[model samples]
Target: MGITYRRILLKLSGEALMGDLSYGIDPAVVNGIAEEVSEIAATGVQIAIVVGGGNIFRGVKGAAAGMDRATADYIGMIATVMNAMTLQDALEHLGVPTRVQTAIAMQEVAEPYIRRRAIRHLEKGRVVIFGAGSGNPFFTTDTTAALRAAEISADVLFKATKVDGVYDADPAHNPNARRFQSLTYSHVLTHDLKVMDSTAIALCKDNNIPIVVFDLSVTGNVRRAVMGESIGTIVGGLCEVC
Candidate 1:
């Protein structure tokens, strides 16, 4: 089956991997995500993933606790590398070709990130997982996703989250909060929406890349989003349709 998007960058939070656990990855949840990704790849969509490390360790949180900010961030980047390896193993177990590339050179475990190689992997129908953020401190994984999406020339950025879509307010707290089917990049930035970090949002905006915020917990939502179904909030030029 052909997908609406030929290529996409998927950004998943470390918290999403946590599932019901307080910290660390939940195998079942990770496996479910891997299966979903495999299904999407089978449909011929090139997928590149960037997994965050907030579940295992948050750099900002660590820095707040008096740790050297750069050191804390570096540790956080390593945490993401761990998540990437686990995800790569799961994807391979499902018989899907996957590669883990890290910004920091940990040649013993994963390949050092190279833009051309990553694009080649996607072109060859392999899932490429980008780890270790931008190899720089003070950069969030969201920014890494946006930067990679722009570099890889992805058609869209899929932000897999617990919530179905972007809302005017915290949907969990305000029962009456309104959910937006679509939103403009300016609107997101102007309102300072937490949909993504400012740097990430600005990067996507500058590159003219659309973003889809969808609930990854839903079994078929990934496929739905890839096929351009109206399942979640869309940010960018396409919001005019909403």
Candidate 2:
């Protein structure tokens, strides 16, 4: 199949990198993901990634222990930086030219997030990884993904999750959970679907950017998603009528 998107934003949860381990980066898992990304890059899809920091630091967990909200969030952002570095190194080792940009402005390690620079990198077939959660404390990485997708003029946001698609309930917990092949922003909001956070969903709706939620655990799912093979539950677009 032909590529589904010319330029796409991929949202990868930190937990996905943990692999069989309880916490932190798993080199084997990182390598596996990097290889998948390389495959997509070879297919000529300009891929930009937004990585979460949950595996390293959870702001809610820190807040429950008396840590200040902003302080905890800053720590979480730092965790994302670490994760970005790990992914960048893995992608580079696989021969994929990569650039790590941070919202928090880490001049020593990464370039400050510049939209034009990022787009230029993508045009040159370089993967740009976005880190630091929008450089704001109150926002989640999900929201960051939406914002970045809009800013980069991405055709779609490929949300890589453990589950194959958006379901009415947790598929792992509820065997009878209903999977949605396609949905609209209204449907997601009306049913309070947890496929993405409200802020992120709202942003996508406003920007008219489509979201494809699919299983990253599957070896070739990334390529399939990028190829527009209907491998996931698509949400937030006029295509919901189809």
Candidate 3:
């Protein structure tokens, strides 16, 4: 068997957890994701996950209504905890060893974010889910994924989205939008592509960690990306780095 990545960070948006529901968690979708993750873990690949909470709450939404930015961000952080807890349960139910670590100190529910402990868990074949969005306000989960990838020394940041790859335009909006099989970090910046937030792109570029953007809606894309299959858009560096 060929194991391409010894370790990787998988980023899942909160919307991905929504399934067919308009909002909130969907058990079936969460279970399907857990199943895929469990299969990938069986390959001996160290996995660290960063999950978004857009389905539950978006900080900007609260801020738009005159709420304090910091307070709204805290609410957003709690939303991530909810999502993290759900994912933890699903992964454990699937018989995959997992840990939930939050940026905010939450000793009662999950472990406090500790880089060393997280690394240890991955080394021991346990999946680590990072929540709370960098433990700070004004930062998106995409930035958190890049930060965690660098901190964990992951081989690549696998950005799981609904789309299979980065396109010249919003494929959903533009039928003629074309996907780029590969792109450099500079190219992404120059084009102002929407592959990730600017902060995330800058962090990945600085840390020399490549990113793979693929469709998590597909059943096996997660495992395929970790296996080094050409199933998504390769960004930041050459395919060899990923």
Candidate 3, clashing residue pairs? Answer: none
lDDT of each: 0.94, 0.91, 0.91
Q: TM-score: which candidate is best?
A: 1
Model 3 ranges off by over 4 Å = 238-242
Q: Evaluate residue 164 in candidate 1 and report its C-alpha lDDT on the 0 to 100 scale.
A: 94
Candidate 3 lDDT tens digits, 1-242: 37788999999999999988999999999999999999989878899999999999999899999999888888998899899999999999989999999999999999999999999999999999998989999999999999999999999999999889998889889999888888899888877888999899999999999999999999988878887899879996553222
Task: Name model 1 segments beyond 4 Å from true.
Answer: 238-242
Q: Which stretches of candidate 2 lie over 4 Å from their true place?
A: 237-242
lDDT string for model 2 (1-242, tens) is 67769999999999989987888989998999999999999988899999999889988789889999889999999999999999999999999999999999899999999999999999999999999989999789999999999999999999998888888888788999888889998888778888889999999999999999998889989888888997879997543533
Q: Once all C-alphas are superposed, what RMSD does model 3 give against the true structure? A: 2.4
Across 1-242, the per-residue lDDT of candidate 1 in tens digits comes to 44789999999999999999999999999999999999999988899999999999999999999999999999999999999999999999999999999999999999999999999999999999999999999999999999999999999999999999999899999999988888989889888878999999999999999999999999999999999999889998545423
TM-score of every candidate relative to the true structure = 0.97, 0.96, 0.96
Superposition error at 200 for model 3 (Å): 0.6
